[model samples]
Target chain A: MHGDQVTDKNLCLALINQLKWDAVCLTSKILECDDDRLRQDYINILNRTFAEQKQAFDFAKQHGWYQPMLAEQTMIGQVQSDTQKMVNEIQQSMMTMHQQAQYQAMPQQQNLNMGQGMGAFQHYAMPAMGHQQQIYGGSPQQYYR
Target chain B: MPHAKGKITARELLDLQSHLMLESNLVGQFNHFARECTDPQLRQMCESFARSRMDSFQRLAQHTNISPIQ
Candidate 1:
């Protein structure tokens, strides 16, 4: 079949994909164990898992839900992680903005003495500001004159 | 060559094994094709009978911290 794409390759690849998705997690649990005997035992367990995978692939051909479920599961997990990251980033930005606003307001607050003034500027003026544009020793009359 | 960062993915390991198997088959198929293949380029393809075959099992074993099952 020169130039004719091998159809079996597609099926075989599909089988491999199914095997990886279905069994990889379970296999990893066994593979990750520290015990060598247990790891070998896990490898041995693959015979059943592989057979079951082939059987499931055949079943899924008619049911048609296998690959879609696997793909959807991964995407859903991805969306959740992405949304969590976005939320964290937004919160971080808000915190930074709040800090910056507090810093900017600190100098202004000190000059105005918002704490000591306590609504004094609303309807009343401070004695310091009331002292007009006279030098320290000059009287108000001399300044006005 | 760019090095990979992060734990070796199970899917990646499986894919590597799958590709190795495919290449081995291709090497076997090439012997016959070398005789029949009219294209000089295709005829020049190399054959490897488990000689240069690389398996992910060893690397996987190292990463997983276990003796290779193979």
Candidate 2:
């Protein structure tokens, strides 16, 4: 179709799409930039483009040119629950790994005696372990006896 | 302003040149679209977009010391 022959609505819709593309391109440029100054400059431009794109989109929507379906509440709730569960699982795994690392950092003799008894090792290693914790800047937690 | 402290690289110069061109072209296109628009609201929106692009173009040109012509 000839450029001039396109209807106003079609032209506006096309401009909206072009703005979306511009936003994506600007985001990529910001991410790929190595220079701090250039990155900041791109970030500013991206922010302005985002605002303009939203304005354009709202204009189109208000005019009935862009009508998107509203998402179901149930779907949103399900996604929220799923995300929370995944986050909790990740945190549990990280805690377990951190405990393992602390255990490995302990003296081998203490580790061997850990299964049999706790009183002796606790008395022997407490001060040294406290020092180690200070050096590592990790909070001390009681080991399960 | 950030460009004041350090020298701009050759690659950065090229990137700024590209941005300036894009922004100027966008300003032209938006203005053209605004003139073609029959609805007052749509025309106003297009004009706003054109002004925004022009602002971006001027900002980049000012900061990078790269004129649109140069």
Kindly give the number of clashing pairs for every candidate: 0, 0
**How would you encode candidate 2's per-residue C-alpha lDDT over A1-145 as one tens digit per residue?**
4676867778689778868877787777666677786788788888888888888888788878899998899999999999999999999999999999988877775664462344454555555565444444565563321
Q: Evaluate candidate 1 and give its CAPRI docking class based on DockQ.
A: incorrect
lDDT of 2 by residue, B1-70 (tens): 5466357766676777777787888889999999987888888888988888887777777757555533
Task: Kindly give the stretch of ten consecutive residues in candidate 1 chain A with the minimal lDDT sum.
Answer: A128-137
The RMSD (Cα, Å) of candidate 2 is 9.1
Using Cα atoms, each model's DockQ against the true complex is: 0.05, 0.42
The TM-score between candidate 1 and the true structure equals 0.23
CA RMSD of each candidate after superposition: 15.3, 9.1
Q: Which residue runs of candidate 1 sit more than 4 Å off their true CA positions?
A: A1-71, A114-145, B1-70
lDDT of 1 by residue, A43-127 (tens): 5545544664565355445444355445678899999999999999999999999999999988975765553434445234345
* Candidate 2 lDDT for residue A143: 35
